[model samples]
Target: MGGSGSGNRWRYGIKGTVDASKRLDIRYLKQHGMLRSGYYSLSWNRGGEPTGNINVRMVSGESMTVIGKWRRDASEEWQPMEKTVYLAHTACAYGGSRSWFVCPYCSRRVAVMIIDAGYVACRHCLKLTYASCNEDMIDRSWSKRDKYKAKMGGDKGLYLKPKGMHQRTWQRLRHQYYEAEMQGWQWAAERFPMIKDWM
Candidate 1:
C-alpha cells in the first residue's frame, strides 16, 4: 500500500513490486550510473515526464524524436545521449515482442532496473537483495495476523462490527482471524521465548 521500504513495516508474504516502466526512469537510471552523468536528453513519447532534471536539450516531432548533446559525465566532453529505445508491442502464438530499454552505461537492452536512493541501475550494478532475505516464517505469520486484525478493525476484538458487511460473513471472518492471530502468537513465541511479554 504505502512505501513499506525505507521504513519498518514488518513486511512478510509476497511483496508487491513497482511498475515495470518506473524502473526505467531516466533520472533513476542516471543516478544509479546506468547512464553516464552529463547534459543528457530524452526523446520518449510515453506521454509524461520523469521526475528528474538532467535534461539539457530535447527535440520532439511526429511519432519519434531524440534528446542529445549529453555526455558520459559532466566533467568529460559533451556527446550524444542514447535516447533511442525500442519497445516491441506486437505478439503472436510463438511469443510477443519484448519491451527493452538500453542501459546508457553498457548499451545492454533490459526490462527492469534496481532503483534506490534516487538512483537507478541494473541489478548487477546495485547488488540488491530480495525483500525476504531476512524473513522467517514466524514473523510472516505475525504479519498476516496483523493484516487480519487490521481488516477487522484493529487487534482489540473480533466481534466489533465492520461497517456494511453481512453479519454472518463478519462472524466467519472474525473466527478465522482469531485463529490466525493465535497461531501467529504461537509461531512468534517459538522463535523468541520472550514474545509472550508483548502479548
Candidate 2:
C-alpha cells in the first residue's frame, strides 16, 4: 500500500492497514551483518513473484541510506528516492546491545519500518495495522489449529506426532488442537445455522 494525496501533505488514513511483509527490519539487518559500513540489496516477493527491491548503504551503527525507485501505481513513472534513517541502540539483558531504527517521521526507536510510496516509517507513524488484526474469532481459531498441526509436522486433518517429541507434550498439543478445531466449528455453526444440524 502506498501513501495517498499529492505534494508534501501525504495522507495515511488511520483506517487503512499496511502490509508488514514489505518492511526493513533492523534486527534482521543486524543479524545478517548488513548494519556494517557496506551496501546491500533488499528485495520482497509474493507467491514466488518479485514485488520490489531497494538498495541500502550502511554507515556502521550510525545510519543507513536507502536508495530505490518506486511508483505510486503502474500508470505512473518510477521515481528515484533516497532516505537516510538513523539508528538507536539499547543494552540487552545478558550482554551486548540491540539495534533499532530511528523512525524518520516520529523519531521513535522501532525494530521494523514499513516501506510504502517510496518512503519508510514506523507503523505507528503510518497509523497502520497488521492483517491479522482484522481477523475474526473463527479465523483465529482456524489459524491456531493449523499452527499446532503444522508444528506437529502434518497438514490439515492429518496431524502426526513428530519424531523425538515428548509424549506428554504431544498429547497436550493434540488436546489444544482439538479444542481450537471445536471452537472454529462452533463459531461456524453459529454463523451458519444450517451447518449445525449436519454436524
Candidate 3:
C-alpha cells in the first residue's frame, strides 16, 4: 500500500539491506521500478550495475521516496533511471548502400542485398515479411504498358529507362512497381513509435 504523496512510485525493502557498492542487474531494477519511463528496454547498451548512494525516505503516512542512478556500461554515460528505449532505424542490412529498398510485406527500408535472401525482414521486429519475388512477377506487373512505353519514346521501356526517369517520375514508378515493398516500409515507420535513441 502507498500514500497520496507517493504517486506512481514504489519503495522496496531490499534498498535498505543491500550494500550501495553492489551493482543491481537491470532485470532486477525493472522488477523494482528503478528505471523511469521513455526507455523501451534495459540493455547492456544503455544500462549497467547500480552505482552511487540511494535516497530513501519515508514521507507522511505510508509514502516514500527512493532515488538512485545506474552505472550504465554503454557508449553513452550512466542513465540515472530505467527508461524505455527503441531503435531509430532497423539494423537489417550488413553493409550500407545508396539505394534503400522497402520490403513489400513489412515496408522496412532494406538493403538491396537482402532481397537475394528468401525472406524479407524488419530490423526492429524480426518479422519475415514476404516469401520472395520472381522475374515473371516483375515482368508482368512492373513493366510499363505499350502506351507508356511509347510515351517515353517507342524505343524506351520501363526497365530500360529505370535510371533514366526523372527523380519525381522514378519515385512514383518505384512506388507503383513495389507497392507491397512501400507498404512494408510505411507500416514499420507508422506501427512503431519513434524513439529519440536506439536501444
**TM-scores of all predicted structures:** 0.43, 0.82, 0.16
Clashing pairs in 1: 28-120, 32-120
RMSD (Cα, Å) for all candidates, in order, is 10.6, 7.4, 24.2
Per-residue alpha-carbon lDDT of candidate 3 for residues 1-199, written as tens digits (9 for 90 to 100): 2222132112232121111123223235435664333222222221465323444332222222333354435565654542111112333377632223344455555432121112222332332222221112223222333334444444444445555668677545444545644443443344343621321
User: Distance from true position, residue 152, model 1, in Å?
Assistant: 2.7
Model 3 ranges off by over 4 Å: 1-51, 82-199
Model 2, span 1-199: residue lDDT tens? 2111221222244344566447998879978989999999999998899999999999998999999999989999999999999998999999999889999999999999888887888888877877666556677788899888877777532456668888888888888889999988887787668878989
In angstroms, how far off is 128's CA in candidate 3? 35
For candidate 1, lDDT tens digit of each residue in 144-173? Answer: 667767777784447577777678877777
Q: Which residue runs does candidate 2 get wrong by more than 4 Å? A: 1-20, 155-162
Ranking by lDDT: 2, 1, 3
TM-score of 3: 0.16
* Number of backbone-clashing residue pairs for each candidate, in the order shown: 2, 0, 15
**How much lDDT does each candidate structure score?**
0.48, 0.81, 0.34
Task: Give the best candidate by lDDT.
Answer: 2
